[model samples]
Target: MNDKPAAPAFDRHMLEALVCPVTHATLSYDAERQELISHAAGLAFPIRAGIPIMLVDEARQIKADD
Candidate 1:
């Protein structure tokens, strides 16, 4: 499954200015999944093509332990 080309790196610096839309809390980067994890919001905002999709509707619903 590791056949695809590596994706563009997400700018880690942007994390400083970005926050979870739902909770207005800090988000953590999940590099492996290319997502921004919002623990407070219980969602994982996906990063596609090096861009973070902060919209709640586009986020994945996550379990507490996830």
Candidate 2:
């Protein structure tokens, strides 16, 4: 394998427009996990490569207690 890291897919402005389906809140992209987290909603949405996996089933639920 080349072992070279891939470049960041989305920038801050792009992420700013992304919203949580469950809560309709803003999303914070986690490049490491490739997941989008909604802190207020406590949900984690997965991002495949540079694209977001916006499906509900693909998303992770976050509890307020977490």
TM-score of 1: 0.88
Tens digit per residue, CA lDDT, model 2, 1-66:
789897558555778687888778888877778788888777788877567877788878877764
- The lDDT, on a scale of 0 to 1, for candidate 1 is 0.96
List pairs with backbone clashes in candidate 2: none
| Shift in Å, residue 12, candidate 2 | 3.2
lDDT digits (tens) for residues 16-42 of candidate 1: 999999999999999999999999989
> Candidate 1 clashing pairs?
none
User: Which whole-number lDDT from 0 to 100 does residue 52 have in model 1?
Assistant: 100
Model 2: which ten-residue window has the lowest total lDDT? 7-16
For model 2, the local distance difference test gives 0.78
TM-score of each: 0.88, 0.70
lDDT of each: 0.96, 0.78
